[model samples]
Target: MDKFEQRLDQAARAAWLSYVGGRTQDEIASQLGVSRPGVQRLLALARQEGLVKVRIDHPIATCMMLSQQIGERFGLDFCDVVPVDTGTADSSYQYLAVAGAERLERYIERSAPLTLSLGSGRTVRAMVEALSRLDRPQHRFVSLVGNVARDGSSNRYDGIMVLADKTGGERFLLPAPVVAGSVEEKEAMLGQRLFHAVTDVALKAEAAFIGVGRIDRQAPLFQDHFINEGELDELLAMQAVGELLGWPMTQDGDVIDCSITRRVTSLPLELLRDQQLVALAGGREKAPAILAALRGGWLKGLVTDETAARFILDAES
Candidate 1:
C-alpha cells in the first residue's frame, strides 16, 4: 500500500480499538507503542479522514416503501424496487434485469409446470439472459406477441426463446407478423385453430412477464421497424403514453381504440388482468408509460429500477 493509505489504515485501526473495540486510549497506545496523546491524535485523524468507517445496513425488506406504495395504489400483488445509476438507459435496464431474474426464478421454482407468458424486448431479453441455469422442463413459456413483421423483419428481443435456452423450459411462439396488413388479415390469422390455441394457452398462464414500452418517436418498436412511420404518427395522435402486450394506452392507462390495435397480434389486456402480470422496465424515458400501466391497473406486479420507482412514487404523491 501507498504511504498515506498505510498511515490511514494504522490510524483507523487505532481509532477502532479506542472507540468501537472499547479499548482505552492508554491500552491502545501501549499496544501500539505510542503515547496516550499520540493515540488520541491518531483517532482524531482517522475520524477526520473518514478512515474508521461505521456502516448501518438497512435491509432490503425494511426499505420497501416504494414497493408497498405501488401495491396499495394499484392493488398489485407483487413489486420489486431495484437501485439504479442515473446514467444511460442500458445501465438502468441492467439493474432491472437482475431484479427481474431473481423474482422470476423464485416464482418458477415454486410453481411447477407453470405457464409463463413472455414479451419480447431488450430489457426482457437482458432479464432472461441473467437467469441462473435451471431445468424447468415442466414449465411452458408462451410469447405475448408475434415475432415476425410484414417486412420479413422480426423482434430480435425474442425473450421467450432465450428463456427456453437458458432455463430448459418448453416455449411456444406465434408464426405470424406482429402487425398485419389489415384488420381482415388479423381476424383471419386469429381465426385459425393454431393461433387461437396459442393465444388461449397464453391467456391461461399462471403468471406473465411483459416489457413496458413508451410510445415516443425513439421507441424500440419504431426504431426496430416493428412499427412504421404511419403507425407512430397514429399513436402520437392517440396521446398514447405507453403500451403493454402491444396495446397502446394513454397517461391514465386506458387502451386507445384504433385501426393499429385491430391489426396487432398480441396478448389481450383483459386476459392479463386475471393473471400475475409483471412488467419490467426502467429509465426516465419510460416513466410516463410505466406510470400509466400502474395507474390503469394493467399490471399485477412490477420489477423496476430505483429512479423509475421514485419517479412513479413522486407522480402519485
Candidate 2:
C-alpha cells in the first residue's frame, strides 16, 4: 500500500482500538509501537475521516427522565432519548442512527427466526450503515414501503437488501412505486399476487423501524421527487404535519385522506397500528411531525435526540 494508505490503515486500527476495544491512548501507542502523541493524532485522524462514531452506552439521568416521560405520555412500549452532540451543529440524525442500529442489532442477535420490517429514509439508511455485520440467516428483512419511485427507479434509501446482506438473511422487497399515477394504478399494484405475498411477510414482522417525515417542500417525499409540488401543496393546505410510511398525516396524527394518499402504495397505517412500530427520527425540523405521530398513537416506540424530545414534551405541556 502507499504511504497515505498505510496512514489511513493505522488510523482505522487506532480508532477501532480506542472506540470499540476501549483502549487508552497509551495502550494503543504500545500496541502500535507509536508514541502516545502519535496515537492521539491517529485517533483524531479517524474522527476527521468519519471512521469513528461515538455513542454513550450509559444513560444520563435527564435523558432517562425524558425517555420515561415521553413513553408514559405516548403509551409507548419503548423509548430511547440520546443526548444531543453539542459539538456538532446538527447531530440529531447521527445520534438517532447509532441508537437505532443498537436496537436493530439486539433483534438480529437473537437465535430464533424473526421478521423485521423497515421503511426507507436517510436516517434509516444511516442506521443500516451503522449496524454491525452478524450471521443471522434465520432472520428476514422486509420493506414496509414500495422500493421504487414513480419513474421506476430504485429508491436509494431502501435498506432491506443491505440488512439481509449484513445478517445473511432473506429479504423481501415491495414491487411497486412510492406512489402510482392514480388511485386505480395503486389498487392494481396492491392486488398483484407477488405484492400480496411480500406484504404478507411484512405484516408478520415482529418489529418495524420507520422514519417520520415532515410535510413541506423540503420533505423527503417532495425532495426525492416521489411527489410533485402540487401534491405537497395539497398536503400543506390540509394541515398535514408529517408522514409515516409515505402516508401523510395531520397534526393530530390522523392520516389525511387525499388524492396523493390514495395513490400511495405503502402498507396501510391501520394494519400496522397493533404491531411493534418504532420510529427512528429526530432534529428540530421534524419535531412537529414526530409529535403528530405520537399524538396519533401510531408508534409503539421512539428513538430520538434530546432536542426533539424537549420540543415534544414542551409542546404537550
Candidate 3:
C-alpha cells in the first residue's frame, strides 16, 4: 500500500484496539509492534482522518444541541430535549416524561428543603412516577392548581398525589375545583384558611413543574368538563391560544384576563413565573403553546421530545 494508505491502515488498527477492544496505548503499542508514542500518533491521525469516527445515538447528546438552541433563543436557563417516537399514540409524551424525570432527579439531589410547585396533569403524574430512587423527606411538593372537578369530581392523575407517593416529601394539595362556577365561589375557596396554606406553599416553591395546555376543543380539560364550553368559546373569542397551568394565555404568551381568570383557583403566574419553572410538554400540537410560554418568559426550563423541539425550531425559522 502507498504511504497514505499504510498510515490509514495503522490508524484504524490503533483505534480499534483502543476503542472496541478497550486496550491501553501501551498494550496496543506492544501488540502492534509499535512504540507507545507511535500508537498515540496513529490514534490522533485516526481521529483527524475520520477513521475512528464514533457517533453516539443517545437521546441526551442528540437533544443537547437543540436544547442549547432553544434555551438561547427563548432566554431559558435550562432545557431537556429528548428523542421521541412521533408515531407513538401518546405523541412522545412518555419520552418527554422520562426526560423531565431525569431533570427532576438532578434538582431533587440538591441540598434539601426543596419546595416544588406542581401542576396537575397526566404528564406531571408520569414525570413523578418516572422519578425513581428519590427520597427527599425534607423537600415538599405543593399543587399549583386545584384538581377537583366543578361537578364534585376530581382528577385521579393529580400531580400532588403522584409526587407524594413517589417521594417521602410533604404534599400540600389545594382541594378545590380548577375553576369555580362563579367568581364568588372562587373567592370563597381562595379565602379559605386551608387554601391559603397550600397556595402559600406553592408561591414560595423553589421550583415549579407546569404543563402547556392547548386551547383547541380537543383539549382534555375541555372534553372532561373541567372547563365549561362557553368559557372555551370565550377564550377563543378573546384571541387566547393556550394556557399555562390553568390560566389562559395569548399567542404572544400574555395571560388573558377573562372570566376563567377570575374563577381559576390556580396559583397566580406571578408567583411561579420567576421560579425555577420547567414546563413538561411535547407533541407537534403543543409546540405553539410551549413557544408562547417560553416567549412570555414564563419558564426557566423545559422538558420535551425531539419532534416537538424540531417543530418549535421549524416554526421559529
The numbered model that scores best in lDDT is 2
Candidate 1 accuracy as lDDT: 0.81
Per-residue accuracy of model 2 over 1-317 as CA lDDT, tens digit each: 59978998999999988988999999999999999999999988877655666666788999999999999999999899988876764555877888999998888999999999999888898898788778999999999988887778876547998788888999999999877888899889988999999999999999999999998878999998888899889899999999999999998999999999889998999998778999999878899999999999999989998889999999999
| Candidate 3 local lDDT, 1-317, one digit each (tens) | 49989988989999999999999999999999999999999999887654543433474776898998998998888888877774764746766676787778887887658898888777887777666656778888888888787778667767777677666788898889877888999889978999998888888888888888888888766986868788789889998777887888887889999778898888888867568988999877888888888778898999887777888887788
Q: Provide the clashing-pair count of each candidate structure.
A: 0, 0, 0
Q: Per-prediction TM-score, please?
A: 0.77, 0.86, 0.78
Model 2: residues >4 Å from true position, as ranges? 1-54, 86-89
- Per-candidate RMSD vs. true structure? 11.6, 3.8, 13.6
2 against 3, candidate with superior lDDT: 2
Better of 1 and 2 by TM-score: 2
Candidate 3 achieves a global lDDT of: 0.82
Candidates ranked by lDDT: 2, 3, 1
Candidate 1 stretches greater than 4 Å from native: 1-63, 153-157
Candidate 1 residue 275 Cα shift, in angstroms, is 0.4
Candidate 3 clashes between residue pairs 3 or more apart in a chain or in different chains: none
Model 1 residue pairs with clashes: none
| Model 3 regions lying over 4 Å from their true place | 1-62, 154-157
